[model samples]
Target: MKAVYINELGGTDVLTHGDRPEPEISPGEVLLRVHASALNHLDLNLRASNCRRFPHILGCDLAGEVVQISPDAGTDLKVGDRVLVDNRVKCGGINLCEHCASGNDQWCARQQRIGVDRDGGHADYVVAPAINAYTIPDAMPFTEAAALPIAAHTAWHCLITQAQLQPWDDVLVQAAGSGVGSMGIQIAKMMGCRVITTAGSDWKLDEAKKLGADAVINYRETASISQAVREMTDGKGVDVVFDCVGADVWEENMLCLKPQGRLVITGVTSGSRSSIDLSILQGRPLHLIGSGGRSRRSMADVMKMVNQGALHGIVGRTFPMAGVAEAHQAMHDRDFFGKLVIEH
Candidate 1:
């Protein structure tokens, strides 16, 4: 099979597109003829080989059809059934691993990402555990289905599980132009919360508003959105703040939260350290929640929402697989809003 794989890691040049032997399917695993695959910022980090194995194919979000199933080990998956690949891989059983015994597969003591720690879907075919492949509704497009496993699931983990977001709550979402932030705004609104978002320009803010953000800030202009949030809430800040931009916005996020409110973080896109006056937390009694992808049930629930048209896929552009370098540079330079994909 022809696929993109990295033999050594350093820069984009390391992401070489070439042929490799087809992967051997294991017990309870099925072969997937991937129709579409999407890229995320994680691809860049994995490409550098900073955290995962070498000679790895870097991609995870995918939609495809089952071509072959392991008859001896699996139950009922068959050839030609349309499916969406779930990226969260688990290890261990029973008391062997605390994470798995608790049913949090994504946090298993030794888990592998579909495209990070293992071979991914940036190819004509890939193998996934039958349990990780989901049947996508015929009405849903493969492209959109491939986009949901990460950002959408991350948003679900944040607003629903982590922050325990409630209806009619006023919530602030940082990095509104980001793929997760784009979906984050929509998820908050779906829960009936009034949404406020902050980004670098009105252009990104416009997209944020269309995604149901009640208010959008051109962060480059205002210099301080905490005041805006306070004013909007009658001198009280919002109930929850969803932030992934990390240190660059920590202080503002601190000021933007209402007393006893929560802030859920999933990543540190900007430089990791920034000064914060500890007094803000002392005064307001804030709570911070850090989250990542969720369990299979949670991922499936969010994807079902997308399959039903409740949440729309916000793809900024689709670049060919050969344009891997450009895509990586664009993500690093912050050149696009929403999900930037590398299509096979």
Candidate 2:
């Protein structure tokens, strides 16, 4: 099987596209003929490992067909079924000791992830536990279904499960142009929150608005993020703040939260070193949350929305599997408004 993998932790040059051995599937596993996959910032982080066989495949989110299923598994479905993968993999499917049973036969006692830790969908084939997949509508296209897993799941986890965002609450979503950010806008709107988003450019802010952001900010234009957020919320700050742009914007994310408001964090795309003030913890009583992907239940719920046409993955560019390096460059450029999809 041909796939993209990091030979070492370094520049995009280390990501080579070529043939590798097919995955060795175990009992109860479903082997998918990957039709399409999307890129995420995790792809770059995985390459930092400098491992020879770091990622057998490169994506967490995938949509394709069930080419083969282990017969050893009990009957539930059959071959050729259209599906999308649930990127989250933890013990008991929810709120369990994740690391003890994550990513494999064993669980993650710490509740880890699948595509971020195991072989993923960035190839012609991938193997996952059957429990991690959901059926898409028969009318859904692999290209569209391919885009949902990670971003959608992560968004659902932050905006729904963790933050418990309420209707009419104000929200501030950083990096509004990102794949996660794009879905985040919709998720907040769907939850009835008046969302404010920050992108690097004016055009992306427009795209954010089209996706349902009530207010958009070009972070480059606004020197003070917290102040802009305060202005957007009528100086009261927001009920929730979802931040993925780490380190460089960490302090600002904290400053934007309202008194007793919650701030949920996932990725730290920028450098992770940042300063914080403890006084704000006591003064404002902000809820700082560190969140991972959705639970199996939440992933399924989000997928249900996709199947019902209530949710859509934002894909701005498509690249062939062979051009994984080019895709990395685009992600670094950080200009695209949605996701960069890789077709098999």
Candidate 3:
């Protein structure tokens, strides 16, 4: 099998595209012929830092056809089934731990992500636990299916599960050009919330508005995003603020929320270190939530939306599997909006 892997994590130069042994399936596992894989910031982060193992393949969002499955895999899927991987590996793929049994696999003590802790889908072939594979709609393209798992699921978890966004609520999404940000905007709007989003460029802002953002802010041109949010809402601020950009927008996020409002955070693309003002927090009594991977149930719900055409996949660019290095460069440059996919 041909794969894009790294001998040691550092930069794009470390990414090696070459032949590797095909993965062998274990009990409750399935070997897939990867057709498409989407790139996420997680891939870039893992590539820039040292990994637990060398020759690591970095990608989580995968859509592929099942070529082999363990006899005791306990799934209804068969050899020719087309599926999308959930990316959140749990209990070392055992799926019998307390967290797994309770539908909170993301909290499992032995939780290991597909791309971060193990070899992932940036290859012609990959293996994943059967439980993490879900059959895709027959009409869906592999590239679109590959773009949904991480970004859409994360947005679903943050907006619906964590924040419990209401129809009347006004929401603010940071970095509208990002995968999660773009998905968040669409989800919030679908739920009947008025969405306010931020992007660095005017064209990106216009794109965000097309995705249903009621108001758009160009952070590069604006001095203070929080003030802009207040002005947009007529001094009331937003009921919820979804922030993936970290320390760089931390303070502004706090100020953009209405009193007693909720703020859900998923990623720290910008540096994570930031100081908080205890006085402001206590005065407003805000809710600050840290969200991680979504539950399988949540992923299923979001996928249902995709299948019904209520939610759409936003793919900004596509690169061949061998061009994984160039994909990383595009992500770092922030040259595209929505998700970037690697076709195998």
TM-score of each: 0.94, 0.90, 0.96
> Global lDDT of each model?
0.82, 0.80, 0.89
Model 3: worst 10 consecutive residues (lDDT sum): 88-97
Candidate 1, superposed: residue stretches over 4 Å from native: 49-52, 72-76, 92-96
Off by over 4 Å in 3: 92-95
Minimal lDDT window, size 10, model 2:
98-107
Q: lDDT score, residue 6, model 3? A: 90
Q: Write the per-residue lDDT of candidate 2 for residues 1-344, one digit (tens) a residue.
A: 88876656788787778887888667767888889888888777676662345544567778888888877755376898998887665554334563434533233455445566677787888887787768888887787787788888888888898899899789999988888888889999988889999988899998888998888888888889999988877788988989888898888887898888899988888877877877777688888898843456677689878888889878888889888889889988887978888988
List model 3 lDDT by residue over 1-344, tens digit each: 89999988798999999988998998889999999999998788888874778878888899999999999888899999999999887764444788777767667767778877879999899999898898888888899889888989999999999999999999999999999999999999999999999999999999999999999999999999999999999998999999899999998899999998999999898989999988888788799988975677787798788878887778899999878999999999998889999988
**Poorest lDDT segment (10 consecutive residues) of candidate 1:** 88-97
Judged by lDDT relative to the true structure, which candidate is superior, 1 or 3? Answer: 3
Candidate with more favorable, higher lDDT: 1 or 2: 1
Summarize candidate 1's per-residue lDDT along 1-344 as a digit string, tens digits.
Answer: 87877888789888788888888888778898887788887888777746457677878788889988987644476799988888877652234478777777667777778987788988889998887887877887777677767888898888888899999789999999888898899899998999989888788888888888898788888857899888878898999999888888888888998788998988788877888798887777999788855787787788788767788667776777677677778888886778776666
